[model samples]
Target: MTVPERPVRVLVCDDQALVRAGYATIFAGYGFDVVGEAPDGTAAVRLARELQPDVVVMDVHMPGIDGIEATRLLAGPDAATPAKVLVVTTFHTDENVYEALRAGASGFLLKDATPDQLVEGVRTVAAGESLISPSVTRQLIGRYATRLRPSAPAPADDGPLAVLTPREREALTLIARGLSNAEIAAELVVSRETVKTYVSRILTKLDLRDRVQAVVLAYRLGLVSADG
Candidate 1:
């Protein structure tokens, strides 16, 4: 419901021309500034650098470079000023979901999602929130993440999150379970602002980039399992 204060700058990338035009139009309709469009990851990366859009709508599979690689170039830890990337993937390439997340995607959007969902996906990531509003998509990220993660195990109780307070830890567990801040607020009988504070503190303590990273860390540490 809340749009960005200014026009959210966006870059749309897909190998298909029609898909590119359609998404650009949709984003433009919603008052987003479609700064540039790219047909492949190489162009996406280049245009993103040249344009400095607030968010990049990236397709997973492309002819050159690909979305995962582009995401890394744009949003990876080494990026001096990382751009927020919303990766668009499909069920068939579910494994790429984890790869994209690992490559520093700010969020995930399934290819099958409708136009409205697609728009919201960009908005969500641009607002610095993960696009896990699609609960099923969030669950799938956890499921695929479990499969793609390495065999090495981590301590369930005392890894990077050992520094968190008890309530913050509980909130993070709920986050890994795909609960939004609003949902977690209701669950904890606290206000949404309070939940936001808790999430901020948790991210600060763990030195994480965003909720997507937090979710991945949770799955890796076995704090929340794929089955759940």
Candidate 2:
């Protein structure tokens, strides 16, 4: 029999002791290792740089250096080996959420999210997947859709992504909109397995590793608008 892999290492950052303990408890139950905790962004950054954790649960607003800035320092384009940061915040305001994501957070979670939701968010981000609440993502897109600039034109339907079929293209659009596979199946009125197949075809045709890159490419190619 094969032995199980090691648990994902997580760093929790929050100003409140109780909040940190709460997350520690939840993560412990899910078989994750809570390797460190920091009460502010400055310390958080230090711990992250030292530990090189698999995931960092960041609180966007904190005293001294804020989480967004710290995230930029740790996970932004310049990092030597970036760690995924999951922004956990109480505020759902458009500016707060957008700023956190723009600062290079791989995912976002609400402070009031259920225990299972919190655990799943950590796991998903650790697995290189983005997990934004559909409701929150939709609201953000709607509010800031017009601010997005137009994408450069695709070359008369010829490019690296041309191998995808019409159905696969549809699936890609929905994926960029952050729809889950089950949701896509319902929207297309097709079986879940059918939707899965289409998604697989889209990924293979485009050579994308996961949905996050698909989302970025959709916006870049104008396949999915900011409003979407």
Candidate 3:
């Protein structure tokens, strides 16, 4: 007989008690392990460090420490061992979204997303994928393009991007433009599996956690203007 698969452990962080309860119910209904819930970012960081859940569903505007700072503590470059963070945000919180992205968040799920979408977002980040929808991503990033780092690391011969093969680099550009694997396959006239392979290789070579960082790098390289 096969052993049962382990449930994905999730930590929900939001200021509102109702929101926290709602998320917990949705995740529990999906058979996910709702390990912990925090009413504020301060508690979020503390609980996450102790429980080490597989995914953290974070809110942007919590009391005490904001979600962006909490994310930085949990997943930032300085984090000794980063936890995957899925930031739930609205379009009005674009600045927080950008900051959270910079702080090493794995992906974004809109606040108004359906219960199914909520579970899917957590699952995506838990599986080491990012929630980068083409239209929404371009809109969010383009609005704050100036906040992006001005340096173009992709062009530098000795930079991290230089380590990728030509095809891998091409895939990275498409990914940056927010193309799904299927869309990328059509654009490049390759199989979807082939695009997936390229994406995996590109991330490995660049030492990136997911497609969000890849998109950021591609923008820095000027591969796509991509305003939403």
Q: Each candidate: what lDDT?
A: 0.85, 0.80, 0.83
Off by over 4 Å in 3: 132-135, 142-146, 151-158
Backbone clashes in model 3, listed as residue pairs: 139-228
lDDT winner among the candidates? 1
User: What are the runs in model 2 whose C-alpha is more than 4 Å off?
Assistant: 142-146, 151-168, 182-213, 226-228
lDDT for 198 (candidate 1): 93
lDDT sort, best first? 1, 3, 2
Name the better of 2 and 3 by TM-score: 3
What's the count of clashing pairs in each model shown?
A: 0, 0, 1
Better of 1 and 2 by lDDT: 1
Candidate 3, residues 87-119: lDDT per residue as tens digits? 886654566767878899998877888888888
lDDT of 1 by residue, 179-223 (tens): 988999999999999999998898899988788888888887788
TM-score of 2: 0.80
TM-scores of all candidate predictions against the true structure: 0.89, 0.80, 0.89
Better of 2 and 3 by lDDT: 3
